[model samples]
Target chain A: MTDYSPLLLSLKVAGISTFFVFIFGVFFAHLFSRKKFFGKSIIESLFMLPLVLPPTVVGFGLLILFGKNGFIGSWLLNWFDFQVVFTWIGAVIASIVVSFPLMYQSAAAAFESLDARMENAARTMGASNWRVFWTISFRLAWPGLLAGLVLSFARGLGEFGATLMLAGYIPGKTDTIPMAIYFAVESGQMEKATFWVVIIVALGFSTIMWLNWWSRRNIERYKNDNA
Target chain B: MLEVQIKKKLPHFLVDINLTVEDEILVLVGPSGSGKTTILNAIAGLDHPDDGRITLNGNIFFCDNEKPLPTQQRNIGYLFQDYALFPHMTVEKNIAYGVKKMNAIEAEKRIERLVNTLGINHLLSKYPHQISGGEKQRVALARALATEPSLLLLDEPLSALDSRTRLECQEELQRLHATWKTPFIIVTHDMQEAEKLGDKIIFLESGLITKTVDNRSGKMIC
Candidate 1:
């Protein structure tokens, strides 16, 4: 009987995936909202597709696209020596894919709530695009983006069917807490599984509470701003 | 030195503009929807004109027939009607934002001078949301001046204030203008404001310049 490595591995995977989601989410959201481009609405819909689709479907799609013999999978394996199937990294990719819509929408809406004049003012002050994004756009949208980050991270935590499909049931390698709980229930280890479930419940509850508190404080600050 | 000629169309208005302002205050007075702000947006590089050129100090800020220089290089400062300060930053960071070339020490000195002169020193650490509207105006002015802009564009600078505060701001604007010596382009629809503060007035109606007045002369009445 292998120990609890899968649980820890899942946490690691979820954390990494959330980081990438937040970084790229904010960037692309800013791009989508601020700068108009070709096929903008289509790009937006594509980003949002995972949000409405079944997690299993998304996992299956990711599998067909990134599995070793698949189109992008073979290219990456040849060029970057990266194989994305049945790994902890695979679990993260699935989580990020599912949760990115939440992040992007929140961040984009936050960016939009801001006055465009601030960016214009920054430009006239000789601040470059990088400067305006960091000093003006990013700073102004901080609270909204933070709320998005927390939502995505929590979304990653609850991920089950997607993680099970994409990362598989490799004990101590890719079996995450959700998959472990499922296996425990199926195999009649109800008591042990309940202990792990409690831990996750506590973590989820506390994380959500903190997120709520942080967002409330941020909202207050924003209100004070518009006051 | 600045020269501008531009034609741009919006949903309900067609903005065709030509203007020049030297080292002096140029007040723009117009009815609502007359394209006064559009002209300011054109000059600020926030809005692109459909055609023509904008030049400043012998350099092209924007020329439709040629490559365009970015707004940051234009050396102008704009005050928003609502004082669109970055809500998160304290008064100091807001001012420091535009003062990129100023060394930290020089920036500090200038920030102090601004706060002292504008009478907002006590509110330096306060957020924009925490300050009174009048204080916010001074803070905005300080932020605009922090960059040492070649020209200052004040968009209804005192319009958001109460009557008493508006008068105070009008006086403060004149005082700051005298000290800074940079060109000021004040935009407002209030004819009284134009009469009080403008050295020269450009009256815009429907995005077109209709009348130009020498406000400093005793010959003009609102």
Candidate 2:
């Protein structure tokens, strides 16, 4: 049975992944929502690829490109000492790749629901493009932004297949909670596996409860403001 | 000063409109899809006129496919048809949304004046959906005036209000026209509203300006 340290590592992996996923997801969603350019649909498709592709396939693709001796990985390792494979960072990268679509789609829907004329009004008020977005567009989209963050965080927490392939279970060094659970169950350690599962179950349930509470608060606030 | 002579065509509707209102309310009165709004849309740089020119305060704002200054660069204000106040914004925020970039004191003073002048002081903390249609109209008016625009474009300000409130809003709009001495361009289909609020009325039918009524008498009438 894997010890508690590996469970802690999994939590760290999920946190890091959620952060990166949220940043990139929102950036792309903003780009797609407010801008017009050539091949915009293609950019949209690439961002959404992870949602449909099997996580294992996504991990293998990353492995091919970022493995120790793989094309980009070997050069990055020798030049920058930034090897990603078999590392905690690698697990975060895989998790971010897998969970990105969840965040992006939610944020895009929120953005789409906004009235374009409101932004136009802000712009005419002598605000720069970025100012209008941050002050008005983002404020209007806050609820949906929270939704995206929660979904991505949840997906990162449950990440297993991609993390396994990209950042193989290395006990406390690289293994995360899901990976640790898998290893424990494989090695006939039911008690340890069950204990870890209980922890995860509690964590997930608490997070979902918090999300639900926050969501309701926002919805009610919106209703009151709109009334 | 505002001078507009623009020709634009949509598939089923079009606007070949022309007007020059130096410093008075020039109302474009017409029914739905009669192209009254399109003329205002063109002036605000919302739509492109096929082959005419629009100059405001001596700046060539837009000309038939010429350099189209975006809606932002043009110092023009448009009050939306249904009072498209930002639903997510507070009445105060919506009014301030377009003027917060002004100096802090100037912005606050302007917002205060607008809120008070429009009789929306009590509704400042509320949002568009929270407020009634009359309140929304006043809020929209406040927002439009906060920018101190060189030209104000109003589209059916009283049309969305209930019958009882429409008369009250009409008087309020009349007071506003008297208070603000800038060029005002209003659009509505109701003849009574046009006669009541317009300094000069231009009638449009199927995108063509078919009649013009100058408010030479300058009377407060309904």
Candidate 3:
């Protein structure tokens, strides 16, 4: 008998986490790319921390922050009797924290490459700041932004360490594909573990293939439109 | 009338200029780094003058004591040296961009008139990267004029075109000016272009006007 709860849970967690990551990632990317102020480098570096930190390190940090007696954990326990630790919400948070930098880096690079003169031309022609961003900057940066979207979604889908630390393995509740695979192997259920490994590899491969096809199609459409 | 009296410090020298133009072309001719584009940028509110006042037809654009009017509200049409056409947009879309305040019918009518006037009717559907340099220049000009700005500034408007296209575009520019009759301030390094297009030419060096030539009267005014 095959259980599909882990697959469904993994997709739900990644989908939710990617949604939040996209909004914050693009927003912060634009802010960091366009504006300059105090402590900008430090703040940007902090955002990039999860990318370089070992998975266990990230998981350990999340544990410290969300563990009972921790600041947010204690407050949540006292207020709503709701604990994020060992729950689906914890998995979403962990995925977001781990996958954020991928989106941020791609979006920032996209924005940084935009020609300032084109933006200035829009401004002199009486386009508002908001209009310029939407019509010009965002449109021009779409390709790179789309790449970030795929990378972050994939990262979120594969998130394991932080999820394991925060959202423990519980069948039909917190058991995601990665958690299921790990436990199945530890318990000598090689067939189940192999099944999950194959599924994850196929998912990752298809995601990347879709991104490439989408990018090429977009470029072709752009050229055809111009022609 | 466009009035400019501004001072700004540059890396090499201080740019100090006081000039005015009314329904005529005023050309700033100088060496590469003599702050010609800087003056145009200041007038367009793209860059600030460290100290001074700029008024277009009596509306204040910038003053030391008052907050500078943002570029969006300045109603100044600037044709950049590189044309600065939006690559992703078609020629017609680029021209129509600055005229969003008008209803679709009126905006379409305006765009039609501009493309016809600039002879870019054939290239309306083409994007910036797909057009020739001359076509790009004409499209950019149409865009600048789309808003019916009270003042027009050109920064090396013909520098990128070949000699043949440059000559043709220069004549087209004069014809457009005659029809529009707004204040025109053009920056150029070519003395011949200054003579051809300018009613008043100011020769600048190290950020100061070294000489002034009234091209209409052919009189030297130092």
Candidate 4:
């Protein structure tokens, strides 16, 4: 009997991580896109570190931060009796850390592309800053933001090294699709590994196709609207 | 009365001007980069002047020493060169955006009146992207007028329209101005448009007002 728990768990981790990633990504993008301050580049570089660092390095860093005896982990354990290490929650964290840069970069690009005049027009018409952001800025940049969301979700789904170091490989509890595939190939179960690989490839392809379709539809709609 | 005395240092030159206007169309006629739009932006509080004061009807809109009221509270209507309509919103929503302080029924009534006056009633449910250039201009004008501001600033209002559409919009603007009874400052490079619409035309050259022509008698005042 083939267990499909790994695939389900991987989807769950990716979905939850993407939610947090989307919020932070858009918020930081909105913040950084409009202002220039001291240490702006430094702050931006720190958020982008995970994308450049090797997966093993990122995983090891997370392990040190969230281990039971570690700073945050120890506080949580003592006060709330809640543990994150070697659990599915740890997997979600790892996924978020690994995938956040993709979301942030794309969102920032989208925000930067917006016309400053449009926002200024809203303000001159007596719309507050908050209302202008929601009504004008976010609405215009939705296409690029949605694309970033999909990319981050894909990145989270494929997370391997961070998940291994933080969540570990516990079947039906923490083992994700990538981890299952790794263990299957290591034990010479090529057929089992192949099955998971096929599933992942199919999912990735469908996402790309969907993204292309969405972009094409938007272009056609724009043409029709303007015509 | 609107009183403006401001000095802004641009990269190319210094923009220093002092002017007063009443309920008349005051046109800033100049070439591109002559600081015409800059004056409009400064009045709307979209751009800050290095040091100056702007007062409208005894209310101080901006004073360099004091914290200027933000753009949202300035109660100025600004029509951008491209109209700058919110592309995602319907024509009605865009017109009603600034009237958030009004009750829903009052807002709806205002929107209905403006839409009918602007002849955009049929386009109320359509997004900006779905409208033609003339329709977009009408919608933008309605949006700017919906809030009942004391002052109106327009930057190159007819520059984006084709010849035929521009003539129609120009007539529409003149008709609206007759009833609105607010001080208007319009920036334009087209001399004909300036002569036709302006009661007092300020000719700017190199960021300074070289001449002020009173078009009321079809003669140059300077």
What is candidate 1's lDDT per residue for A54-117, written digit by digit as tens? 9999989989989888898899999999998888888998999999999999999999887888
Q: Quote the positional error of residue B202 for candidate 1 in Å.
A: 1.7
Best by TM-score: 4
Q: Model 4 over residues B82-189: C-alpha lDDT tens digits?
A: 888877778888888888664878878877888888899999899888888899889999999998889989899999899999999888888888989999899999
Q: What share of the true interface contacts does each candidate keep?
A: 0.92, 0.40, 0.73, 0.83
In model 2, the clashing pairs are A226-B130, A227-B130, B7-B50
- Report how far off residue A204 is in candidate 1 (Å): 1.8
lDDT of 3 at A3: 88
**Model 4 over residues A1-227: C-alpha lDDT tens digits?**
98889889989999999999999999999999999999999999999999999988998988888888888888889999988988999999999999999999999999998889889989998888998899889988888899999999999999999889999998889989999999999999999999999999998999999998997887676554434
The lowest-lDDT stretch of 10 consecutive residues in candidate 1 chain B is B213-222
Candidate 3 — which residues are off by over 4 angstroms?
Answer: A213-227
- Candidate 4 Cα deviation (angstroms), residue B196: 0.2
TM, every model? 0.94, 0.90, 0.94, 0.95
Instruction: Sort by DockQ, best first.
Output: 1, 4, 3, 2
Q: Going through the candidates in order, what is chain B's TM-score?
A: 0.94, 0.93, 0.98, 0.97
TM-score of 1: 0.94
- Summing lDDT over every window of 10 consecutive residues in candidate 4 chain A, give the lowest-scoring window: A218-227
By DockQ, who's the top model here?
1
Quick one: ranking by TM-score, best first? 4, 1, 3, 2
| Candidate 1 chain A: worst-modelled 10 consecutive residues by lDDT | A1-10
Task: Tell how far residue A31 is off in model 2, in angstroms.
Answer: 2.0
lDDT of each: 0.86, 0.82, 0.91, 0.90
